[model samples]
Target: EDFVGHRNGAEEFVIITTLSFGPPLHDALTRRLTEELHSFYNFMERDQGYVLIEDGSGKQSQKPLMSAHITVSQGEPDPNAQPSKAASTSDDPWVDASEDQDQKPDSSKPSGSAFDW
Candidate 1:
C-alpha cells in the first residue's frame, strides 16, 4: 500500500539522513506533531457525542481538544539500561553518509523523499 511504502521510506530516510541533529530535527518533529493534531481535531469535530474533560474539578465544558492534551513532560530514561551502539560509539548522534552507503538506493537523489511538510 502507498501509506506503508511512505512510512517505510520515512523510516529509511530518518535512519540514513543526518538531519536527526539540531534545528532540522526539531522542525521536522514539530511539523509531524502539528499534522497529527490537525487529524485529531478533524476526527473530534466529526463526532458530536465525544467530550473531553478540561479539569479535575468535574466541570462539564466544551473545550477544544488541544486544551486537554497541552501539558507535556519528558520521561526519564531508565538508568540501568545499556547505551545503544550509536550512542556508545560517538559523541555526535548524526549518522555519517560514509558509514552506510548502501542504506540508500539512490545516491543522486535527495536524502529525504519529497514531502509537502
Candidate 2:
C-alpha cells in the first residue's frame, strides 16, 4: 500500500500510509488503506473516525501527520489602530484617523471597553 493525502492549513485532511500486512492481513490492510486514502483524497466521511475535505482554494499543503487537530484564530485588529501595549493600556483611545470628524470620545480618559476580553 502507499496512500497519501493532504490539505492542512486548518482545512485539515491528513493521511499517509505505507502498508504491508501480516497479522491476519493487518485488519484488512488497515481497512483498505483507510478506504483507499479516503477515495484518493476526495474525503467526506465523518462520524466517529472523522474525515471532511474542502480546500476549494484556501490553501494548505505542508504535510506531516500521524494525527492532528487544529483550530486557530487571531484576526481582527485595526479598528483605527493603537491597541498593543501587549494589547491594551497606554491611554488606549484610538480611532483618530487624522481627527476632525466632530471629535468626541476622549472625554479626558476611560475608553478601553470594546469587549476587552
* Top-TM-score candidate index: 1
lDDT of prediction 2 = 0.38
lDDT of 1 by residue, 8-79 (tens): 223232222232243564567667866765565556563553446455688767644432112222345599
* Candidate 1 Cα outliers beyond 4 Å, as residue runs: 1-20, 43-60, 67-117
**In model 2, how large is the Cα lDDT of residue 90?**
30
Looking at candidate 2, the ten consecutive residues that score lowest on lDDT are 6-15
Q: Clash number for every model?
A: 0, 0
RMSD of 1: 15.6
Clash count for candidate 1 is 0
| Candidate 1, lDDT over the whole model | 0.43
* Model 2 TM-score, all chains together: 0.17
- As for candidate 1, its clashing pairs are none
Model 2 misplaced regions, further than 4 Å: 1-22, 25-27, 43-61, 64-117
The 0-to-1 C-alpha lDDT of every candidate, in the order given, reads: 0.43, 0.38
